[model samples]
Target: MPLNSYQHPCPGGYQIQAADMLIGGTLGARVNWGDPARDVVITAGHLVNNLNAAVFQPGAGVPGENQRIGHVAGRSPLRTYPSSREFLGTRAETPGQRITCRYDFAYIEVAGDSAATSYRIPGINDTDEPLAVRDPIEGEPVHWLGNTTGIVLGGHVRDLSYWMTMELDPTNAANRQYLSVQPLTLIEVQGTMPTRGGDSGAAVVAVNDRHIVGVHCLGGTTRKGRPFTMASRVPASPQALAEGSSSAGFDEVLTWIARTKAWVNS
Candidate 1:
């Protein structure tokens, strides 16, 4: 079957389909445990919450035919922040329902079977070497691994420090209720690395390298009609992850996975 026929976006890996397929909507990220002894995956909370009845395939080719890994029963609360009104306006809203801004991310626990074993990416086993988060040097090659175009799309980071506003709806009464959103980590790319509806939640990794600097979470067209991508830093510092570890959070997600799941075989 054509890859686009599948429900999820693509990055072309045995586990990519397995992990991404279990997520709902077009947004979800692929995560590694940084340990080979145990198996784990991470994604947005909204995606997993909508996946209660979904089955997780471990190693199957294509989007929907992977081996059953597990199901997402509980998830850390996390919300996907869109980059524009057009994107948010496209979503369905209901009355009396509250949207969560915190914990917009979640982690999946996988069994240590052959399928999980085969999903390993070497040199990811060590957590000691802190991942690099250097600014993209001009003319330096970069890449993003996302389900864009129903497959993994890669391109160089064309520009940096790009900024734009998006729409946001607050679920709580405290703080600013509604406002336009802005992000600093905007990126541009060339070639056929077109991002589409389901490409959110991908990792913006350095090309030919294992360093993952940002997460592909949003996209939009510029005033000039050119497409661009946006991301938030993974927060390399321990202190930063601690502060924003709750909603629209990553620190809590990663730390939660570390405590709840046995990613490293003891």
Candidate 2:
């Protein structure tokens, strides 16, 4: 299905743009791990650096009305520690500067009523099946519905720990910063779908049971010029958001939404 266009009860795998940023990324998944029927929008950390930033859909031919869907709720620092994310730079990175992170994923608290969202991932699992989450298994076939390249298939987890840097580059009207992250359980996929811009934040899923696996964070050529597609493994544990890890890249973000987040109002 064409996901770039506006969708009511916006499901997973749709285009999302931060109102303050010029570019956009995919809202990888609609995970309702709370009391609400449709609770949060999950995506890459860089897209939601500023918590509470307004978020909307960049749908073509769709009128501009009712576009403001939600706001950034939480994010995990993509870099830190020999055991976990702490000590060193633990703040979420911003655009226009290089970032060091351990887990490159974040979650947005969905606003409005339950009708405003759906957990279904179009073309992959349209039913209201209980969405399961897990870490990516190497060599297992996978699928991800990207806003730019819809319904990507024939891919499998290749690398569970790949170091790389992510950047928006020049010409982007907003967020022209660089992101440099360590291995941190980076899930690399190699196969049919050639990762491209706007595909960032796409959720990497297993083809067998459609279990949510990883967050497609970024992709690019290595110093040797070899192309690579990378993602952050889905949270196996979000304990204290990795603040207690004595080793590096051991935790992933998810604790904030595992329970409804109590937003601290100013």
Cα-based lDDT for every prediction? 0.39, 0.61
Give the TM-score comparing model 2 with the true structure, all chains together. 0.71
Model 1 residue runs over 4 Å out of place are 1-38, 50-55, 58-66, 71-104, 112-140, 158-184, 235-266
Instruction: Score residue 148 of candidate 2 by CA lDDT.
Output: 77
Q: Once all C-alphas are superposed, what RMSD does model 1 give against the true structure? A: 12.6
Which digits, one per residue and each the tens of the lDDT, describe model 2 over residues 1-266? 44687777777788888766667888788776432343677888776657788778753223574466678776665432232122222335322232346677777777663465677887777887547777777777777877877766446565565554455444653534554454433333454346677887887888897888877877643322334467876544444234311232212322221211221110
After the best TM-score superposition of candidate 2, give how far the Cα of residue 77 lies from its true spot, in angstroms: 2.6
Poorest stretch of ten by lDDT in candidate 2: 257-266
**TM-scores for candidates 1 onward, in order:** 0.49, 0.71
The 10-residue segment with the lowest total lDDT in model 1? 1-10
